[model samples]
Target: MSKIKIMKKFNFIIQSKGGAGKSFFTYLLGIKHEQNKETLFIDVDGSTSTSTNQLKFLEDQKRIGVIDLLDSQDRIARDRLFGSIEEIAELSYSNYILDFGAPESEQLPALFSRDVNQQELKGFAEFLNSEFIFHVIIAGGTAYGACMQYLTDIVRVVGEEFKIVVWMNENTLLNYPKQVEQILEAANALGLDVERFGDVLSGSVFDTKLSTIIQQGLGKAGIMKSGYMIQTQMKKLTAEIII
Candidate 1:
């Protein structure tokens, strides 16, 4: 068993409107934390729209996404799920991504319904408390404001320290083609310390190709506003901040 990397800095929450790239960005962030192995991803989207193609593509990349774990009723299964989350906190290898996407027709109603305190509900909450789960919300243009309010209410009930990420990742294969700058600028005004990254799915770079793109982009000025750029900035910026 690998030692899990317990997150030192609370949890990250990416909350946005429906089409704000929450689903894809969640996977990307989870991938970044893979080496920590203690990372967990809770889908909660229950979206059937892009499940077929997107998730399928992610699986092909050998990512440890958790959508397949939705049908376990065994106590051992629950135990495995719970233990895996905590176990990954100090480990190396990103096998700890948990997909919380339930069937939309089934679990989507729960989000709208008032508190039920069901057993499963309690278990899920327990899972979150034990695991420093990051909440990534998809904030589409029309759905942004309402989702923030809705998420605020939900997180209040859950009592988790989720860092809201307002993603402005474009879906086209150009990464940060000229138009994203304005969108990212607006996102920065939200007071959430927004982080924007290239929509890996929509970008032309893959694996080594992506690495080169990041290397070139990081050192530049104008084209460096993307999420990857911010991560680089965070490293340098935090180096002397000394928490």
Candidate 2:
């Protein structure tokens, strides 16, 4: 495998709410960095395995490793999971996008909140900050309130070391044209630095022409067009991402 070019860059496509396009965006982020830099797309969402499927091509080609977190079961599985996480922390010198499963995200804060054993997770975050620039990708939708709360939960757990990027996934404009305002309000209330977050992006994957063309069997040509459309969307989103 090629060495990662950016050492301190970590992107976690996180959202407690499902159907928010986390996996799709994860695939796009991987594509954005795959060609020019060392990129590792870790699929931690074992339930849906959406990212795992989307990035299967990369895994098959040996360009990425899609880890199905659901596969981590039993004591042995948990041990392996811990080992893998530690190994990544130790050996990761490339850009990484961890598609955190909803169950894991929901459990993480609680797991890390305990007084006695929280040091492990805190240490993990510290290792990330010391070794890589950490980032959180918040996927939001019509449920704007839930989105804000999710962001708050993440910030509370991870602290202020990481930059946040919010994706307006569903009914983006129709639901909240002034979504940024809502975010700002929430940030102010929570005492989070608004400057620490990046601009929001429209992350809708279903409204594209590709989704329509696929039903008509437009084949490779339609697929190519959809790919271009997705690329354009990803370019805009990544451009505003805080390093």
Q: Candidates' lDDT values, in order?
A: 0.39, 0.53
Sequence-dependent TM-score of model 2: 0.68
- lDDT of residue 11 for candidate 2: 60
Instruction: List where candidate 2 sits over 4 angstroms from the true fold.
Output: 1-8, 68-82, 90-93, 115-122, 125-141, 160-173, 188-206, 211-243
Q: Please report the TM-score between candidate 1 and the true structure.
A: 0.41
For candidate 2, give the lDDT of residue 29.
60
- Residue 21 of model 2, lDDT score: 54
Candidate 1 per-residue lDDT, tens place, 1-243, comes to 996543233233334344454444443443344334343343333344332233332333344333332334411233443454445443443334333442322232243234333345445545544333344443434554554454444444443333344434433314334444543554455434444454444333343443443333222232244457445643442232111
Q: How far is candidate 1 from the true structure (C-alpha RMSD, Å)?
A: 10.0
lDDT of 2 by residue, 1-243 (tens): 996444345566677666555655564465555454466677777676666666544654455555544343411144444566666655545666687777655555544354213345445656555342324343335556665677777677665544555454533434555776776676667555542222234344534543343234232333456677644544565554333
The clash numbers for all candidates, in the given order, read 28, 3
